[model samples]
Target: MTSRNPWSRPVGRRSVLVGTALGATALLAGSQLRFAGRSRAEGADPWAGWQPPVQSFPNTFIEQNVPIPMDDGVTIRADVWYPADESGAKVPGRYPVVVTTHCYGKALLGAMADYSRYGYVVVVADSRGTGASEGSFGLLDDREGADAYAIVEWAGTQPFSTGKVGVDGFSYLGATAAKTAATRPPHLAAANFGGAPTDPYRTFITQGGNWSSSSALWFALELLGVAPLPFTLNSYGGLDVQPRNPTTDIATFLTRLQTDGSSIPYRFAELQRLIDGSNNFDNGFWQERTTDVGNIDVPTLVYSGWADLFLRDTPRDFRALPLERGSKLMAIGPWTHYSLPKHIGSRNDQPIDDLLISWFDRWLKGIDNGVDRLDPVLLWENGSERWAGHDDWPVAGTSYDRLHLTGTRSGTSNSLNDGTLTALPAATAGSDTEVIDPLAGVCSRQTVQYLGGLPVYLPIAFFMPEFPISEFPGIDQIAPCFRTDDRANEQGALTWTTAPTGTDLLFTGPVALTLHGSTTAADPVWVARLSDVAPDGTARPIGEGALVASRRALDPARTKYSPDGDVVEPFHIHTHEAVLPVPRDAVETYNVEIWPTSWRVTAGHRLRLTIDGAEFPHLLPNASTPDRLGTLTVHYGPDRQSFLNLPVHQGAFP
Candidate 1:
């Protein structure tokens, strides 16, 4: 059900008075194409020393302070980027429009003049209440969706528009692109959504039934936007003014936010309301803020980072959007949420921006530049340091390989590196009991950290006052062993590692874990990770998944099964109704779906699986109860076997 104000007309003075009083009530919230070039193999450099063909237009002209009016009479702020000819005159023709909505303010996201150079009229707008736009923010509210629809349509009808429009952005902005596409606006031709999530409640707020504490840091960054600083918007390869809106910058945004009596604490308290599971069920609140990607019918380009926060949903989004046979395209890279700006494809020198521009050119400008003839999927295979092209996302011939969890035969009782993952069942039945400390944080060697157990590079890594290095994604984690090299000796984690492999083992699909376990407490959260253990003993995380024991039921209706109809979806039961407290003393079977991935465990390399009770910062500490600690027992054997289902790509490899 979509949210719309009953009264379509502008809110009268009386309504403003009513709005002020009701302010305390709520807090909210792939396509195919063909390419003509020969399919690039998994390990080839397609873009090395190659540059995208462009019109070579001169400087880009910016039309600042544009106000786009929505149905409810709220005006959203936007900056339109137009192209200039060699003679310094503005290009004189209706051009395809590209719009991006930003939560960090229009100025921060800025207009990518590069697109303008290619004859695209790019518009970047700030979500209402955060920048120059006027209105209360509902955290990606339906109003935002409504505003997006209006803006795209308006851009289409503009004198400078060719009635063709496209949308692009990452994270919050990526989500806005999806929302705009969902409205199925007539002029919406295509979309490029990078690092966006499908379900806001599940992936962003209460992730896997746990609160994302990192959200607080995100909120602080939003607050910091109050003071617009001159910063380089490296992602777009341009210098961007922090606050594009002259009137109400971050300070004004916060001031007006508090003037409504919704103080910072109230805002956080509302977040806590969700964290406390008060609004755990999917209802109008989540719906008002959620975008139905199935509603999006435009050709779409999807971008996902294996090390980013929304890894699981990338493929899910691709499967949802129904586009032309060859219109849906996707590229999965080895990147963190912060490292997406660098055009580097993992270690490859190819600029990701080239692929992006070619995509827009094909869809928005109707230029057949060979991008449509290429394979629909481009996946970065970690460890192999190569990119593979596939006709379908979990390309054909992908088979699930099972690895049974044998007992920890080593001296380290609770170490994750002690156990074994083998193709055969354990010779004998057994069980392992380990204590799960709710307070165990990321620094606690025993846990599987979110986004690959990597050290957080924000605030701390943003600037080294002494050395002052340029901060960017992938820069911090890859800077001289910033993250741990091995977790083999971690104390509290239970791990299972396979013996060295004689042949290269490559996988390109989703991963799942079946665990027969019991916890002493009614509520228990399980963290599972699949990593690669090099012969030298360096353990690098590949993918991870988590589930609050209570939220264990599979919502078959919403879950997608595999093409072979044997495996389960990568995610299940996101609503509160699916949550069920674990039976205190009885062992229960829990199915944990590790996020999808594409990796190659080379010869002599071992695959590892680690399970633990908690990972801080990534998720809020499990519901703590004073000094009480809980014990989790893993039951294995014929009757209660635990194993991992890894998707082995039977397709061609590098």
Candidate 2:
């Protein structure tokens, strides 16, 4: 059903000659430029202190039920917001169009009014088979990407359009922008891809080869949103039958999907099939859905948060985009997926819309605002609470510092400080072992105690508030009130603590755990976390990484090697092409890449590494059943040395 796209002609990118008109508008506008207020108590708003300028637009008019034709002949529904005057009449001049497409209907999108009022035509479209659109929805199917491109081209050709188009949104809409921009749409002047990850398999479904319990819920939500029934329609005003050829059956496909959804366990089974079937490599299925960042040649703006689920790959993809230095921008904020509004609301800042307007103002409207003159990297250091800009990520002068785990295996249960993390390795061989009940980790406690475990199967809409399970990202845990219980440290975790830092230690890059260890089971999963232990003993996680023993081989093709030749991929090892399973009861040196972090461990704060068998709910427990309990042994010695490699900014230390 692939149709030749007439508008698919590639548009070569112009050499954006960014003039040196640097403005005083702080790239990441914040109050202070110090290192003290970085880390917030768990659940505190990371964006509480900073205030960004709020840009508002006036005279917006909404036009609903616009039928956009895709190459596959499906009539996708869109809500177009156009610039209007106080007399309730359309503004005469044509303006650049910004198209935001998602499975969720247009009405839920709040940004449309803002963009439209500011003299741009904003089109929020419901992809085929969702909301008011036609065709059965296949999540991330190639057709959706094609539909996105068609929608953009359709908008570009409209009389109200200035023949320039831009795509923007978060999550699904971000993904739509990525796919559409990759196609090199002739009228797509720029794109703002935020919160949507470049790699779905690595960042979304199965991170580190470990499945998430929330997969089934995601599948159910997708199916529920896409089913043909009127009841399944998204929040796009209402479920009105479109005037165009009205042959849509409201009950048939809806009943089928609902019947399928009734067996919640089967949904998980289907999800597992996709994970296992892919064998964790970039297969046809993943490649079809994933955006080839290398092919994206537009002036793109990428955004992510330290606590956002899709946070890992956004920066990586931003670096991959084939745009000129000044053409691409990356902004990493402090709020989680949910707390973004709270953070922005606390400070009278725009909810990522200010940056969007500034970007669009420069690229689409041809405004010579100095946004292009600002540094490409804008980040919020967690503990420091200050916004900083840099020419590149892992800011210029970062160096890797390794902390060695030194101590012996002692008590039956893990003590808060069973082992020490030291600058020097143990003089002699030292080993520590801990028994793990895969289903009995930190997340399990929340599921069983805090919110009933039923949230695991319920739709996110039904229980996101109490469920606390936000897919792999876990945005609920970002609240200033949310702190990991000390009980998790006692339950089957091998703890390694360091002497309090005499002076502030600024760690602002990728982190990794090199483990010379062995597990009793063949299919063991290792969850590791790097935490900041405050002077008062409250442990807050700085970053976390995991590994599934069976999927340990690195895929050199997909793996991005460091420029200096030291192989480091922040967060997770980009390994998938080959499956090198762990030999039972054998010691292997695993170079496990933990997620990246930007934090400062102030003087008197100690660093800790807790290694456990599982990070439940966040990741599905080890494939092993309860009967096959496994014991993991972490080895540290001259022969089998293990350490946590942290990217430290020596220059930032005061």
Question: lDDT for each of the candidates?
Answer: 0.66, 0.63
Q: Distance from true position, residue 489, model 2, in Å?
A: 3.1
Candidate 1 deviant stretches above 4 angstroms: 1-51, 85-89, 111-113, 224-245, 248-266, 344-347, 408-417, 439-441, 444-473, 479-483, 560-567, 622-628, 650-654
Q: Write candidate 2's Cα lDDT for 245-279 as tens digits.
A: 22333432354355443223444555767555443
- Strongest candidate by TM-score: 1
Candidate 1 local Cα displacement, residue 162, angstroms: 1.1
User: TM-scores for all candidates?
Assistant: 0.84, 0.78
lDDT of 1 by residue, 1-654 (tens): 011121122233234444333322321211111112344455665334323547557666676668888888777877788888776568788899999886676666653226887889888887766666766666778888888889999999999999999988777778888888999889999888887865777766655677765454455555533334333242344333332335544555566565663324435665667555576656678778877888888888888777667666788788677776568888887676656343544356555666677778888988877677666777877877767777675564454555888884633234833787787767778877668766554653223223432344544445643333333445545533224554732467788878777888877777778788888866777888666777667777676777777777875545534322223444566665656666776888888877788888888778877787776656674333321248777778877778877667532111
**Steric clashes per prediction:** 24, 11
